[model samples]
Target chain A: MSIYIDPAVASSLRGFEMPEKLGFGKVMAPVMFRAVCQDGCWSRGELLPYAPLALDPAAKVLHYAQSCFEGMKAYRVQGGGVGLFRPERNAARMVHSAERLCMPPVPESLFMDGVRTVSAYCANLVPANSGESLYLRPFLMGTQPDLSVSTSSTCEFYVIASPSEAYHPGNMRLWVERENARAALGGTGDSKVGGNYAASLLSVARLKERGYDQSLWLNPGNRRTVDELSGMNFFAVLDGELHTPALNGSILEGVTRDSLIELARDLGYRVREREIDIDELLGQVESGRCEEAFACGTAAIISPISVFGDGEREYRPAKAPGPVAERLRAALLDIQEGRAEDRFGWMQAVEAVGE
Target chain B: MSIYIDPAVASSLRGFEMPEKLGFGKVMAPVMFRAVCQDGCWSRGELLPYAPLALDPAAKVLHYAQSCFEGMKAYRVQGGGVGLFRPERNAARMVHSAERLCMPPVPESLFMDGVRTVSAYCANLVPANSGESLYLRPFLMGTQPDLSVSTSSTCEFYVIASPSEAYHPGNMRLWVERENARAALGGTGDSKVGGNYAASLLSVARLKERGYDQSLWLNPGNRRTVDELSGMNFFAVLDGELHTPALNGSILEGVTRDSLIELARDLGYRVREREIDIDELLGQVESGRCEEAFACGTAAIISPISVFGDGEREYRPAKAPGPVAERLRAALLDIQEGRAEDRFGWMQAVEAVGE
Candidate 1:
């Protein structure tokens, strides 16, 4: 890999100390991966000391939000080794997101190099505990110092790592958002871009005030079928079958969601991906036909949904942490942490620096 | 106004030179206005040298698009002075946009102080020409360095100025956008936020390739009625009357659009604000009843539309720069450039520094 390692990176990493209380995404690592793109030509990647970026006030990303990002993790394998779970999926999704916003894609090779280099150097930062890993965030943004409402001419990509504990939201209670749409029908909802998350902040704030953990977004086009949560995909176990929202244009194609489906099928369960109406799902929950519901994302592998708050009514699922969700979560984690056989070949091992 | 004028600001202004080619929003001034907010409490505004910002890589604005901005102009007013047109309106609209993204609003006093201070200090930057002015951009963004999907705890507000000529697209050719939507039904369409512009870039890129100037976006919900242009409001002269799309939730409430509607009414032209069906308007244009069409915005006060390209069919207006559009544009420019009386009290005078 033709990557430039800044001399200060080793010193910065040496001086860094991991805090005892490492919350999710709060304790950042000392070093970061950086790359730049001019017009359409990408530069070589660099491992630099993590520091604040000096950006022009008129940079396109600051005003136009032409940015996309990915979320993955570097797990501590069985014998102190680090492995990235489905890093290629994140690389592919990020390219799709960049295209949606008219940004130049970070080449797949560059993406892998960035994630692997960060994982290799920060191997010690990956927490040595079940469900705890070094959360890796790979983001690309337009950095051209122009104020015109157009595509930026230059861009920047960075991979920042966070040494943290697993995100445990306990059983989440979701609020059915009916008024504000997260993204438009033909909008950037399917892409993991900054605008989609920004558009959902208000709805999330409103739900939090009403004691809801997350906003269960509905399809903006129809306003009846279920979309996903803000940063996660939704799933429900109904009548001995696992059901989830299909790969609609407005729904984000989550890596964890797909893996769970495949893993569930392997565990002797039938999985279905189709449009799940909000009203019908709520009815199923109330009638006990839907045994359990859960949300999945890179941050929290599987967060069980205990209740659905739709206006004045509250529908509780039959099981908060059902057997199906527990089994799938354990199975996925075992493979990620190298406890189980790499049967699906999902993990990519990284050589720890100075090992 | 309790603004802190930095000592270096005077030297920065003195050493600055206006570029010969002052295109719209390209030639930036030497100084700017800035303020910081921590947990909803705003600091005093400051006028300092215009420079790059030091932001953390994990800043919430970079990843979540938690940003909003406003565009207005500082014109060389009567008696060799500088005046801001409807500055308070921009402040209020910015507040609305900030709230939509769950960011704290810059207090009205703080917002006015920032704009007025920048205008006063950079008074010479206000170009003296028929369709020229110092374009002022006031923006707010979240600055907290965290990776969680939530609002930032700290924020930054800035007012940047660009001395430039008017934006002229000539008689524009608009493409009727059918596949992509700029903003959703209950999304941030009405707000001056970054996500809306980011989402519209692809559509604009596609339309530009087809020999069109801009995308005439339709309402996302129905995909039939005209919402507006990408950044400007749409207008047409039908049967000798001024008609524009009403203030739909999905259409931005442009200050130029409102001002034109009021000015047209005062000029003895009947103006109607209603839902404009794209098909019906095309039919009227084909029948020669809709004589002319135009768009209005802060950057381009009035841009005449020559043709509308819709799926292999082209509809041309009878009068490209119709009499009504020409008259309205002239009257508006006259007022903005201080060639006429400020009858509506829309202009706020800013005392030039060292005057």
Candidate 2:
């Protein structure tokens, strides 16, 4: 569904100026797209200047945490055109996330409209360089101000863009987080809901104290199998093959992780999706059977992990950025940066709307 | 801190009238309280008329779920007075919940002032029934309008109230929630936060479809131990003594649970706080060792559990509102209703500011 843009949007986009230092997601674009859903019927979305929201203090999203969001990027594909990578995946995952929280699912068509509209209008704000792009955050929240725990009957969906530089996930050491599970069994771990992230902050805080950059969360069902990181998916090189956790109920289906799996297969690498038992994996890392491990997400693409620590014991690899991680990162960046073929049909080229 | 009464508050409260039917937390009170915090320092709270909150579209609370809240009541005690039962506990729990999300804590004094001021001004709205009261909801949110996941530097706190009737918790048949966890292990289960409630909504919805009232969550760490109900603490009268899951990291420290333990001990009943394994609990029920069980919180003073359904198996207790639950519910209600003495100093009497 095409959106009817307001006349003021052009002026807002034109008058907007980008900050010199574009942090990860701190700097937002000038224009946004918004839609409302009341009693299961959705209204037509409108593109307007970015503005603060008006909500009752007792809104279910504020008090009950009935909110979910999607993270995707508008890339400056080759030939100076803008496009989005795996936009449909974010839309589908967002639907699942909303269902997990008992909120009405923002339709995939509406989700795409919001993302594509903002991305096309703010194409000038899409950053250059390898990792930098205009990060699009599409979020839906329950707006009915009430004190009950039932499903919210009213909802609002908005797409806000942040002009971001390549998120440089610095040298990372991971802590084998055993005590805290990010999502519980049959919980919203597989869905991208706000509650899952809120539940993870405590573990991330503790891992930061232990001098680790991220916590390698274990599966909540068994507390023995490997789950994804707080915001990314994990990949380890074992026995000359690439291995990642299967899509369990508690692991988010990351877009970046999925792209890498397909790319790895195309590049003639054997990939496996199975449970990585924490104890067994740690032992393999200690014994040199597991050579290198890394994490992948849309924000940073791929970040290599150098060390894995569990309590006092530590496991370090001979190389921080191993050959496999480096090769995969460069391959993915090549496609994203327009330096390679568009054969995989991964990127959807968006027409640039004049500022 | 002394607060200046806003002129608009008087008009809003005067114009507001109780609705014909007051469901739980549905009809909101007209007035509210607000305070701002920056860099660990808090501003004096002001009681103003309740209105829609103005928030940035990219606020961290909406996106990252950096928000926490408390549930409590302000009872219109017998003899023409109003009082709050152990509200300080909620204030402290809100602080802990905020800390878990890395957000600034609402100052204890500021929190107290907000609740008391709202309750004092809206004392007339409190229902005069045995189990009914002015349900007070105190929530703290990260209001900084940025989307990145690090805790917000600026925050806002608000206390809103809802006029309601007695929460008649019928004899509930709980579904043994072996698959879904309300909160994660090492997660925010123990904290009074929005995320935990949102995560539990799915489980509640699924169990309702299966003809169950609420979910009996298991300890996420082991998945075999009994934690508590979604928002209440669990207690069972086994072998003529009160038994509850000990204050494990996963179980919230319910104020009513604490008060009941104290009141029960003083009334010559032995109480034990230990790990209540689910298997052992079911066995005890079958063998006639456990006679009755109940769940307690501010909303429902004491809700008796009638049956436990674990997937294919169903265990019906010999008694629903057994002698223990009946006695405890009456004992607690007497103090709340001002019929009995507040011997433990649990009630804080609030003098109504009548014109």
Candidate 3:
């Protein structure tokens, strides 16, 4: 793949040192990939030193939130290689998200070039741990310096990598967000857009004041069905069956959620994608029928849910890290870390740039 | 105002030349006002040359939509002076918007200093016309350079000016949007946040394709009652009585909308702030009871609505610019432009710098 390599990028990468404490999304890699689009035409991708972006004060993304992003990981394989897990899905999902905001999509080829180039150069940054990986964030934002509430004529796309440890929120306690809705019914809920995350911050802050780890958002339409937990998808194991919310336009179609659904079925567990009502799930937890619950996303593969706080009541699940969650997590990690056969054909291997 | 004025600001302002044709929000002023906040403590404001903001790629606002903004105007007032129309209202509203996004609120003093300083320096940019003014945009955004989904500890506040003609979508053809919602039941509808604008863009784009000038969004909860236009408030003259949407949590309490309601009442018209259902409004329009309709905002003071397009049908009001709309618009403009008596105390006179 032919791409522009900034002269300073090699030096930046060579001079950088990884931080000792690699918390999630904290330690940034030295280099990044970038491309621009103007009037629906995309420019070639480039690898440059990671630096601050000069955006006009009136840039559409700054004022109107015309931005979308994807979260994926590049892992250090057992055989001293770097691998991306189903990056094509993130590329396609980003296209959908951009279209929803009336933005020009970054073509699949350019998207691949961005992720692959960044990962190849940052191969040493990929953490060689059971759960840790180099977190890659591919984002696109409208850059046109106009204040009108219209589609921007120009856009910027970037791929930035963070060398980090696995995000583990131990056994989490979730507060049922009854007052605030994360996304509207026909809003940007299904897209990986900035607006959805921004809307969730206040709710999360309120819940945190009450000693909760995250807010369990309910569907905006009914305010009863479980939508999601900020960024991650929710799951519950009831009667040895895995149940999660369906893709109802208001829930983000999380890649980790999809992979877990597929992996659970392959492991002989009954997986169902249906509307899991919050009240019903809470009742099941109260009755001990819901054995375990967890949230899944690329950043945190699977985080166990210990308690659900609703109003003045608390409902605890039968198990925090239940048997089903443990088995599925181990199986997924085995494939991701290259400890097991790549039977699912999920990993895409990339050669290191300096190798 | 004891604010630090950059030396380059005077040069930038002196070099700026107003264009031949001034369109709304298109031609930006040469200088801007800025202030920074760290952990809720605001720094002194500064007036500087308008330039691109250098933001980190991982800034909270860039990826999380943690931004809010206010739209007010500095008008060429009587006696060759400049005045702001109800800027305190905008300041309060912006504080609300910032708090809704879990961001530190811009202090009222700092907010006033920013807007007033920008307006004072750009006094010459205030277009001397009946319907035109120097559009002042005061915005706040989270600027902390961290990728974690949390509130930013640091923020930046800016006041940018645009000199332009009045935004007049003369006799707008509105589409009754039944599908897309601008906001949710418990979402940031009342707050002037970026997410609400981003969500409404697609609906507006779709309506424009169908020969409609704007979309008349409905309540996200019922999808039946009239909410407002994307950035404007909805009003209808029903049986010679002015009616607009009440201050529901899902409706942005538009500054212009509130002023119009107050002005209409003062002008001896029966003002009613109640819910207006879409079906009932269309039926009234069909029966000729709803004589006129219009939308109101800071940029477009009062834009008449000519038609409402629902699926397969169009409802034309009896009067596009009805007597009531005209009277209210003229009365409001008179107060805003300093032609009418300052009975409401809505105008704040500002002394031009270097006068």
Candidate 4:
């Protein structure tokens, strides 16, 4: 893909020093991938030095939240090379998100070119330690300078990488968010858009104040069924079987969630994808029927839920990290880190650009 | 307020030319007002030449839509000077919007300073026509360059002005949106956040394709009561009495909507703020009991609704611009443009900056 390599990229990369502390999404790489779309035409991708973006004050994204993004990781595999776990799914979901916001979709080829270019060049920055890797964020935004609440004619797509550790390190306490919803049914919930994330911050903040790590949001339509956490999918182990909320219209189709389902089924664990009522799940947790509960996403791979704070009441599962959750997380990581064979063929190896 | 007025502002204003065509929010003024907040402390406000904002790529606003805005106007009063109609109300509403998105609220005094400073400097650009004014858009966004799903520590606030004609110049045909929702039940619908506007765009685009001007959204909580149009509040003249949807948690309390309610009462018209079911309203429109319906906002003061396009049927009000809507529009405009006495003391006049 004839991507443009900015002249200063080499210097920026060479001059960059990896920090001693690599927190999640904190230490950004020195270079980034960018492409622009104007009037339905997509420009060739370019790798340029990372810098502030000069945006018009009246850009649609600043006023209307016409933006979408994906979180992914480029892992430094078992032996040598780097691999992207199901990058194609992220591209497809991003297309759906762009269409939902009426922004021009970045074609799969262009999306791949941007992701691969950034991953190949920044391969050295990928963390080698277990539970750490180079996190890639591909974001698209409406850049047209207008105050009208309409679709933007111009768009900018960017892919920025950050070498960081895993997001959540310990068991999490979740507050049952009955008052606020992350997204509405028949809304942008299924899409990885900025509005859904924007709507979730208040709930997370409130939960944090109440001594919880995250919010366990219920479905907006029914207001009783499980939806997801702020940035992850919800899962529980009941009666020695894995249960997760089905892909409702208001639930984001998480790539890690999908991978886990496949990997779990392959590992001989019975997985059920159906509507799981919140009250019923909480009851199971209290009755000791639910062995463990967890949340999964690209950032936090698998964070076990230790306590469910529902208003004044708190419920805990039999185990914080049950045997099933531990097994599934290990199996998934082995495939992701190339310690085991990529039986599912989910990893896309990216060739590194030699120094 | 001691605002920092940049030296380059004079040159920008002096060299600016007004475009012949003044579409709504199209012709931007040459200068803007800006202020920054870092770690809970706000910087002094500044008035400088309007220029592109250099934001970090990882700024929370771009990736998570942590932004809110208010639309207001500085009118060219009947005699000579410019006046802002209930500018304090806008400031108060913006505070609520910012708080909902977990951003630091722009202090009321600072908000007034930004709006007044921009309006005074751009006084010459306020259009003189009845429905035209200097449309001022005051926006606040989280500017911290972090990828974590948390509230931003840094924020930027700005007020930009556009001299333009009224939005929605003619009668509007609205499509009854039954599928997609603009906001959730306990979402950012009541606040003037970017996410609510972003979520409404898809429904608007779909309706525009079906020959409708806007989407007549339903209350997300019940999905039956009339909530609003995309960016405006809904009102109807039923049985010669004005009725509007109450300020449900999912409805934005518009400034125009509130002003009209007060003005209508002064004009000896009964105004009701309660739930108006969509099906019942459609039936009333079909039966000629609903004389006219309209949408109101800062840009579009009062736009009469001609038809409501349900799935396979179209319901029309007896008159597109019935006497009630007509009289209310004229009354509101009269006070706004200074043709009538500011009986409610809503107009806040600003002294122009000498050239």
Candidate 5:
């Protein structure tokens, strides 16, 4: 499939200047990839200059939340080449998310074209630092101009990029969120839709008041088992073994989480995926059985956990950036930055297009 | 506070023609009301021609669902005058919904101004039929371009109207939604946010496949007690008494539902608000103890439920639109349409501007 390149995109890319400080998802790339879908038929992909989108006020995405998105990064690899880490995984997960909201899925081919086109054109924007990359956000939203609580007949898909530095929460303090559920049981928890994120803001606000970094959410059904953090998967290093919550229907399946699990297994570590009860884990932390815990996602590869505040008490993990977390973070970064061999066949290199 | 009326609005309203057929929320009014909020301060309100909104692709509302809205109507009463029903209740509820999503509330005065301004200008478009009126949708959304999962710093508020007909789901057949929950116990179910409606589309689609019109949602935590329909409150006529699920924090308090309860009480019908167990209610329906069940909202007013399709069995209500539902719907609409005396002081008459 051929993509139509807008003539103005060249000027936008040429006129752009890289900012000295690149925060996570702050400064956007000059160019974007877009495609429209009407009545299940997708339009030809287009690479255009980044601009504000004109949408009808009655669009379904505005009133019914018919939107889903994916987060991945384009890395400035060895020899100044660009590589995308597990782009197909994000495409597949986006399909799942779209289906959960009754939206038509973007074809895998179209998804790849979108990411690759943006990554190739914006290769100059991928940060040269080890932990920094051009973060690509591919989002699809219903654009039908009707104020009804049903499926949308039209959709708009776009891929936007941001050159960013590593987002380090500096040994996060997670509040045991026993009061608010980020996603509901049998709801849009496992999907990367906006509703789950919207439902989490109140909890994040309340946790901020208590001087916490993020929320350690429990399962929405039982409110007992540990689910995941707001946007990352949780892992606890328990007595030389790593244990994380199994993929319950209510927990989002994170790409970084899956990659780390595979990397851990390849490194000869015992990894267990099962339900981790909140109370039991807190007890383990108190008894020194749980050495350290960390959260992982695409934005921040790994965020170490220092303390878990439950009710009136705090359970301190024995190690903040313990040996296990440090090892995994370095291993993943090494692979992502092309410092190590891509033995897992995880990297997809894209040819750069000069302005 | 005075509102800035756009110069083009007068011509837009004058040139607009009502379509021959008006569906619910389909035909948009020619003009709209808008306001912008930066940080915590709001700009002056403005009334402008209804048009598409230009939003940055990275706006928080499109990515994180930081949006909320209210549904209401301006009735074309007797003597061709316009009246708003319980507009203050919707204003207060919009505040709660906005705060739930961490967006700043549209001040009650600002809210009333938006609705009243739109209502007054679109008075000629209000349908004259008993169940038809000018449906007004006042929505607030976070418009910040940042992508982090935090509260938005900038917001946009708009009120768009539609000359809509009565939305009648003609004797709805509800499927016992045992697998999917619309909202979570500690989630945004009670708030009029987009997430709750987004979470409900898949369930509605699934029920439609099974030959049902709507879903009979249960409590998200217990999954036993009745909660509500997608956008409406649930009510049942049991042994000649009116029964509804009590406000349990997970059910959206509907303006129509509250009005019906009050009107029923004044009409000398015993109205009870308590937890209604799903299984027990089904048993009563089977034994002919439950006379009829209906759903209420601003759009539909009263939707009679004729069949409850459980796993393999179906329980039929004794009446589709029972005498109780008909009487209450009429009593409520009578006040709205100015047929009955406004003893409850519910209607706020708005002066219409002639073209």
Candidate 6:
């Protein structure tokens, strides 16, 4: 798919000012990539000036929540280069989410085209800090203006970038949410859709009030096993082995979670994916058998899970951001930032734009 | 609160025509009611022309699925007057949906005023047909233009009306949806939000090809008891008694469902609200103990359920509009259409508009 570059894109990017302080997903890039789909056929992509989109009140995305998005980052590698860490995984996962909503799957090639084009154009905006990078938000929405309870015939896909710091909610404390189940069994739990995130805000808000930074959502199907965090996947080091919840249909198959598993294995750590029952996990954490735990995602690369509070019982891991998390984080970051060799071929380099 | 009357509303209402066919929610009313909210404070309501609403692409509702809605109706009661059928129930339910999405509840008085005021002003437009009325849609959406995944501080609430005939998908053959679920356990299932409806569309579309009118969604928590249809509640007549699923937290508390139960009980029919197991109901239907079944909503009111098509087994009800359903529907319609006494204190009479 050929990209139609608007002549104004360069001026927009050039005139943009980098904010004095960069926070996660707060400061947006100057330009964006947009594409439209009509009757299942997609149009050529465009690199245009960033602007607000016009939507109708009855648009399906506004009402029915027919929206999905992908989060990834373009980083300035240590030795003066730019790279994306497994962007194709995000692209593939977005397709899965779209299909779940009966929306046209954004083709893998188009998905790559959008991300790579945006990353290349916004390369200057890529933060040079070790944890900071240009965060790319690739989103698809159903924009049909109607009140019907059916799939929309028109859709728009856009890739917007936010240049900022790493999403490290340091030494996170979590609340074990029991009253609400995030995604139901046979529901859109595993998909990276806006609805999933929307459904999670209430719980997050409730937990935040109770001095918690996140919620350890249990599997909706059984309400027993540990599914994941709202936007991240969970992992615990039990008896010197890395254990994470298996993909149980309702947990988002996170890109970072997957990379961590492969990297951990290569780093000579035994990683096992299985159903971690909530009760058993709490027990293990309380008994100090589970050394440390953390959550992983594209935006927040790796956040140390400090403690889990379920009702009156509080289970604290032996360490937060312990030796294992620190090591695994370094191993993954090394490949992503080019500090170490791209041994696993996980990093995909993009051509940097001349400022 | 004072209403801002847009002059365009008068013109739009004057131009509206009664279409030859009113298929459910397809036809739109000429006028709509609207109100805005900012940081938990609400603006005065407005009655305006029904037209396209221009919304920002980055609006919270589109990006984060921050929206909720209510479905109710203004009926041509049997006494030749317009009256709303238990609108407060819809108001309470909308509040629940709003809270789920971290939206402030539209005040109960505001909710009642919006529906009643719109209905009274448009009373002349209420269809005079036997099964036709003005279907009202009250929805709230996050209107802030931002890409962040948090509750929008600014929101807009609207009540739009559409006069329509009965939603009679005659002799509905329902597909037992075992794989895909409409809402997650801790998800938005209990709330009448857009995401819940959008999630169920794929299943309905798939089943439509299989000659089914709707998909009978099971409870997402325990894939056991019946949850509901996309926008309606389910009912079954077993061994000459009225039965419906109890208000498990996951199922929406439907106004029509509540009304029907009361009507059935008042008419001296044995009404039971409890779990209706899918397999057991199928077995009962097959063995002829379950005489009939139907679905109910504000638009459809009461639609006969004919066949329950599970993948391997199909249970066809002996009677579609069974005796119990017919009796209950007639009694409710009589009260709604002015053909009987308003004995149960259900109807709220709206001011009649001069032709």
Of candidate 2 chain A, the 10-residue stretch with the lowest lDDT total is A316-325
lDDT of 6 by residue, A8-50 (tens): 9999998999998887776778888999999999999999988
Worst 10 residues of 6 chain A by lDDT: A54-63
Encode model 4's per-residue lDDT on B18-133: one tens digit a residue.
99998988778999999999998999999999999999999999999999999999999989899999999999999999999999999999999999999999999998877889
> lDDT values of the candidates?
0.93, 0.88, 0.91, 0.92, 0.94, 0.85
lDDT of 6: 0.85
Residues B218-321, candidate 5: write the lDDT tens digits: 99999999999999999999999999999999999999999999999999999999999999999999999998999999998998999999999999999998
Model 3 chain B: lowest-lDDT 10 consecutive positions:
B320-329
For every model shown, what is its TM-score relative to the native structure?
A: 0.99, 0.96, 0.99, 0.99, 0.99, 0.94
Query: lDDT for model 5, on a 0 to 1 scale?
Result: 0.94
lDDT of 3 by residue, A68-124 (tens): 999999998998899999999999999999999999999999999999999999998
Candidate 2 TM-score, C-alpha based: 0.96
lDDT tens per residue, model 2, B1-355: 7875788988888888898788789889999999888877788788888888889998888987889899999998989789999888988999899989888888788888988989999988998777888999999988888776667778899989999888876999999898888887778888988888899998899889989999999998788898999889999999899999998888999999998999888888999999999999999998889999889988888999999999889887788989888888899989988999999888898877545
True contacts kept of each: 0.87, 0.85, 0.85, 0.85, 0.83, 0.67
Model 6 misplaced regions, further than 4 Å? A7-11, A79-81, A352-355, B14-21, B77-81, B120-125, B145-148, B352-355
Q: Name the lDDT value of residue A244 in candidate 2.
A: 99
DockQ of each: 0.90, 0.76, 0.88, 0.89, 0.89, 0.58
Superposition error at A138 for model 1 (Å): 0.6
Model 1, C-alpha of B36: deviation from truth (Å): 0.7
lDDT of 2 by residue, A103-158 (tens): 88999999989998999999889987768899999999998988887678899999
Q: Which stretches of candidate 2 lie over 4 Å from their true place?
A: A283-289, B286-289
